[model samples]
Target: MTTTTRTIPFKADHVGSLLRPERLHKARKQFNRREIKAVDLRKVENEEIKRVVDRQIEIGLDVVTDGEFRRTWFHLDFMEHFNGIEGYVPKKGYQFADGVETERYDVRNTGKITFNSKHPFLKDFKELNEIVDGRAVAKQTIPSPNQFFNAGIQNEDIYPDIEDFAQDVIKAYQEAIQAFYDAGVRYLQLDDVYIAGLSAPDIPFNDGKYTREYLIDLALRVVNGSLENKPEDLYVTTHLCRGNYRSTWAFSGGYDIIAPTLLANEKVDGFFLEYDDERSGGFEPLKHIPKDGPKVVLGLVTSKSGELEDRDEVFRRVHEASAYVPLAQLCLSPQCGFASTHHGNELTEEEQWNKLKYVVELSKELWG
Candidate 1:
């Protein structure tokens, strides 16, 4: 375990993509239909993204992303850029129960996880690098190998063997991570909603002799295996979320269920945890945070809705968490992105900035 006394105080989250105005969305649809060349769509998206990045910097954010401008959503768009993967409509569509009805989409299969320079993600980052002011750290987020592997199973095609799938996905990401580093991205976060599935009691992965602990070990192994021998300069982290769609969640559980393994086992620079609501449980689990390793970015602000958290109350929560981990090791941000998918959640654009401004203000108040 390595510890750095030097603290980097900042505010940022999976802030890229889905800010695509209606025109860009139309262009992307046309490109997908092959009615227009990808280059044409890329040109428009590039210009629009630059505007978004500039706004992020102008608003006083320490880190900036491309607003996932070119992406349909974080996972689908990223997976679409890869080769060995293919998307097909599932026989029985995914269904999530969250009061209001919503259906899940098709799962991904590892047709191939090879690296290709032509991936639009490269261009996306390069353009972001050029526009993002040097003063602000540029960050990129990708679906964790866990999220990728879990997506490989569609409907009833239960993978008889997961290790084969896990290793392949890891290799694919290892290639992607190396490429991102070569392209000059330092801070990379692996977003994995499946991390929370480790705690869901109804889920079969945790039933029988396979306790939740045992399954979590498997999940971590899959992702950590992908990160083995990664570049030392790359500041890798993981974001654990219950599930975020249109400001509604898919699962509810406490960090107490998975903290020991996550805080102690998973190898990464940090863990961005969803702590904006009561469903995440109390701060006691944070005591398990390694005193010697892995920074914890408390997602103490909610991104689901536009409601700005009470500033003084947020400060009090940060102070309360500091009792377990040093204040120096803590950071703040929204629990998740304003739009985890294409719809951009239920908040207006103005609400999104207001929520982000609250994060920037709160972060400066604590660490500054």
Candidate 2:
């Protein structure tokens, strides 16, 4: 079992967020309407966090998060909070597949980009660090450098050159990583969905000055850059996401297209990869992972649906992927978070818990 004594990259882990509960939804609405104060809202948030964290421990997870209960979008809330960046709704909504539309709000660098200690997540991490009973290690999740860059489109007036822009981003992430470490976060997960989306066949992104390939190359470089000089004890990993919205998906394709470059070059401790459906291609591309490279977490279980996958069948898939990477170097998780957004997947909360409980049980079956 992975514990404080064991390094992270644990046998069974889910992407950090769980579906938001009803009370949390109501509290936000209340706060938005000024029916409650921020302090009152935090009281509610803290209470729910206790309940959720206890459930995660009871579910037998070695790694736990605060369920991202305080935020709306996982990537946006964290990235937009960075110093020198400000948020606004874009001219058009982000059009995902199946015509799912979301208000296209984004960030732009209004001044020289920098890291601020008041970047709320560090405070959030400190609270979670205190909340966990120390039975299960609390892990913090942050948006990757690529996600930050993708969210904040390049402003020629602000950054004349892409490389010049990347330097600030790299420095900001380096600072953020250190801040989280200082706050007692030893296991951090960088959620980099855009990088995985870039690998898909369709290039659905807003890029007026940069090509898809150019953006992809820059994302790879910046992510690796942020990881430079990370503390040796902190286990920093990444979840390569395909869009997860209410059981819907945005990008389709395999890591094959980006594997040789992104996976081989990425210096993180491990990868949480999506392999829940045919949309994510075969495990053959996993062979490209260098022998000394980061380990892999086989995201074989689906967070998009409520139906729990069969245990034997799940193991069958793990064994199949092991043909490319050693089983010893692999772990299991959901393809993505049950709630990448506050609305979460189509499943009931009970179903979501069952899915996590299943991963814990399955990991024990395979790894113990």
Instruction: Using TM-score, give the best candidate's number.
Output: 2
Q: Can you write out model 2's per-residue Cα lDDT over 1-368, one digit (the tens) per residue?
A: 33762557889898888888899999999999999999999989999988889999998888899999888888878877888787788787566679997656767778778898888888888888788857788989988888766644667688888799999999998999999999998999999878988888777554576677777788888988998878889888999998888888877989987888888888888999999999999999899877756889999999999999988889999999889888888899998998888889899999999999999999988989
Measured over all alpha carbons after superposition, the RMSD of each candidate to the real structure, in angstroms, is: 3.7, 1.9
Clash counts for the predictions, in order: 6, 0
| Backbone clashes, candidate 1 | 6
Considering only N, C-alpha and C atoms within 3 Å, which residue pairs clash in candidate 2? Answer: none
Candidates in order, TM-scores: namely 0.89, 0.95
Per-residue lDDT, model 1, residue 209, is 42
Candidate 1 Cα outliers beyond 4 Å, as residue runs: 1-18, 30-36, 97-104, 110-113, 151-159, 207-211
> Each candidate: what lDDT?
0.73, 0.86
lDDT value, residue 105 of candidate 1: 55
Task: Output the worst ten-in-a-row residue range by lDDT, candidate 2.
Answer: 1-10
